[model samples]
Target: MKKEVNIILAGSLGIILGIGLFGLRKFLKKKSQDYDDYYADFHRHFVKQAKDDGNDGIEFLAVQ
Candidate 1:
């Protein structure tokens, strides 16, 4: 009986942890992609303005 209970508890814990990890991975994946899009958009707006204004050209340097 005791061994059966231990097995059940362990199985439940493993399942819960698996679910948590999956959710965390998904959330992080979305955030990572979104951050890139937002970063590009910000740079794009600035570049657009500089491109339109011949005398207001800007230089861009991206460092990882």
Candidate 2:
């Protein structure tokens, strides 16, 4: 009976950890992709302005 209870507890813990890890991975991947998009958009929209406007349009950060 004790052994059976231990097995059940271990199995439950494993399943919960697995689910948490899967969710964490998906969230991180999406965040990474979003950052890539944000930087691409910033470069596309701002680089030309910086060049055209000279020092007046220089930017170090972007907000969406």
Best prediction by TM-score? 2
Which pairs clash in model 1?
none
Q: Candidate 2 regions off by >4 Å?
A: 42-64
lDDT of 1 by residue, 4-64 (tens): 9999999999999999999999999999999998887667755634345444334432321
- Where does candidate 1 have its weakest 10-residue lDDT segment? 55-64
State the displacement of the C-alpha of residue 23, model 1, in Å, after optimal TM-score superposition: 0.5
Taking every candidate in turn, the Cα RMSD to the unseen true structure, in Å, is 11.1, 11.5
Error of model 1, residue 8, in angstroms: 0.5
* lDDT agreement with native, every candidate: 0.82, 0.82
TM-scores for the candidates:
0.61, 0.61
